[model samples]
Target: MEAPTVTALQTLKALVALQEIDVRIRDLEKDRQQIPARMKEIDKLLEEKHHELSEEKNQLAEVELARRMLESDLKAEKEKIKKWEARLNEIKSNRDYQALSREIEAARKANLGIEDEILRKMQDIEDLKTSVSQKEEDLNESEKSLLEERTELKKKLDSLNADIAKEESTRAESLGQIDRRWLAQYDSIRKRRDGVAVVPVLDEHCQGCYMGIPPQQYNTVLRGEQIVTCPFCHRILYYAKSLEEMSEDKA
Candidate 1:
């Protein structure tokens, strides 16, 4: 609770400032690490879409092949009917001619049925082609949008890298401003306390743990004199106003 030397107050300020930078660095690094996983998810989605499209096209191809085969069978049936018709004039008996005419009639009926089926198959092929076309268009649009999103993530990753580098470039100077004893203590506490070695006292509560501090300790922190730690959390403390003042001075 005693008055703090100007040097001690400055050291406290330096620790607070350094904590801000370290927290930012940790967050940015975490976000940077997640970009690859996100990109992989995007790629997987695209792959699934492509597989669906390929299956549709394959079905369309199969249907078209079936239609062609039907047409070929119809042609063969008509040729057989034509050859049987040509034998009618050469037949001498009535029964023979009647039998040959019945054969031609049956062949014509079969060709008619084949023609109907071919028409239906053609319609199915057309429907499938339309569906595949629509799917391809949708897939292209999705790819464009996802690729844009991926590009934006890349830009964000680059921006975070730059910000981290800028903050780190100044970290050494902040470290130099602190008393070596306090700096050593801050590093030790940060490791043990989840990277939060310095916290602000707000309304007589330790921001780190949200636990109430002793009134005397709160008053000591309010004066911005001497480094204090929360009794419950044992993390170093500073008055919130002191940090604001330091920030304003820099601005």
Candidate 2:
């Protein structure tokens, strides 16, 4: 068997290194993609909570306004009763006195009805206050957690971006070491083969497609004298040193 040439072995090493860089870059980009979706989910939850609190406050405002208006009506009715009482003493005829008395009774009945309505309004106002307090508490708790989560997501996204940038620079340097024709071929193959351009041949099996390699192709790969591509997946085939081969080399 012919010994492997230095140039061929060096090309294989470069290709392997380039593949590692590409894989990591893809993973980091995927992590970066996930950050925004998670942050958006947190924001959506907070928005819903904010709306709930606002609605409760608005309800409280409406209840308070009703209570104030009712109080004003009560004051006006009391004043009317006082004026009617004074006018009763000034009446000279029995018929006039009786008519004034009836008018006063009607006014007092209306006042009683207004007082009952005021009491009901006060009860609603108290219930609304409790609801507003509970909603505010819930919002505060959610905001604290949302703030923490948003911060963490941003940090993760920044880290991923930094890592991806570093890897891209490294990949550019690695491209310079590889033959242009080989690099071009690798890129073309990766585009069609799920970003996997190079794979190991283990025990006559093509790792890319898990297909059995032909005996002639297997021999060429073991010799490492030429570049070989898998016929099935069209991925560049690499010959990995076996445990026995490594042991023998050490000895």
Candidate 3:
């Protein structure tokens, strides 16, 4: 079998290398982008935790204020009871004593009610304190995990960036050796079609779109007369060796 011309072979090699580097770069960039997204997710979770904690603390404060107010009211009621008892000493009739006794009973009931409310508020405050402690613990743990994750991601991004720099240097060297017109054509097609300018023709089919090649076009590709394009996809085409052909070539 006839070998491809030196120019064609070089162009093929360069294109293949360019494709490799491009794929690596694209993959690395995707990974890099994921770092930010992961951090954003962590940030959102932390923000939600903070907001929940803030709301809980606010509720606790309100309950505490209510408890204090209830205590003050209880104290004032006790004071009123003392004054009523002193007035009972000066009661001049059974009617007056009965009226003072009724007033004392009402004050006692009101004080009991205030005490019950204060107890409920204290219970609520205790529950809130527990919740706040748990939330803070969770926040601390998450923050630690986030810091470690950020460090790891940063290391990976740095390594990928180094690889990209090396690959870029190699790609530039390879690109310089390709014919200007062919490079221009490749770039133009790649820009228009998702960075896939050249595609292999395999099994008498265009790999780009899996369209069958007519006998005439297949003959021209075999002849290597000129650069051929797939009619369906308009991508520059080259004949790729089959597995059998590859084995034979290797042998």
Cα-based lDDT at residue 78, candidate 2 = 94
Judging by TM-score, tell me the better candidate of 1 and 2: 2
Please provide, for model 1 over 1-86, each residue's C-alpha lDDT reduced to its tens digit, 9 standing for 90 to 100.
Answer: 22244455677788888999899888888988999899889989999999999999999999999999999999889888888888
lDDT for model 1, please. Answer: 0.88
How good is model 3 by TM-score?
Answer: 0.82
In the range 1-251, model 3's lDDT, one tens digit per residue, is 22344455456546656776777777777777777787778778778888998999899898999889889888988998999999999989999899889989988988888888888889999999999899889878987887788788778878888887887888788786677777777778778888787888777898888999988997676555566778888787776653234347668
lDDT of 2 by residue, 69-133 (tens): 98999999899999989999999999999998999999999999999999998999899899889
Residue pairs that clash (backbone atoms under 3 angstroms), model 1: none
The 0-to-1 C-alpha lDDT of every candidate, in the order given, reads: 0.88, 0.88, 0.78
Predict model 2's lDDT versus the native.
Answer: 0.88
Summing lDDT over every window of 10 consecutive residues in candidate 2, give the lowest-scoring window.
1-10
Stretches of candidate 3 off by over 4 Å are: 1-6, 223-225, 241-251
lDDT of 3 at 146: 76
Error of 2 at 172 (Å): 0.9
Question: Which residue segments of model 1 deviate by more than 4 Å?
Answer: 1-6, 30-34, 92-105, 179-195, 215-225, 241-251
* lDDT of residue 42 for candidate 1: 91
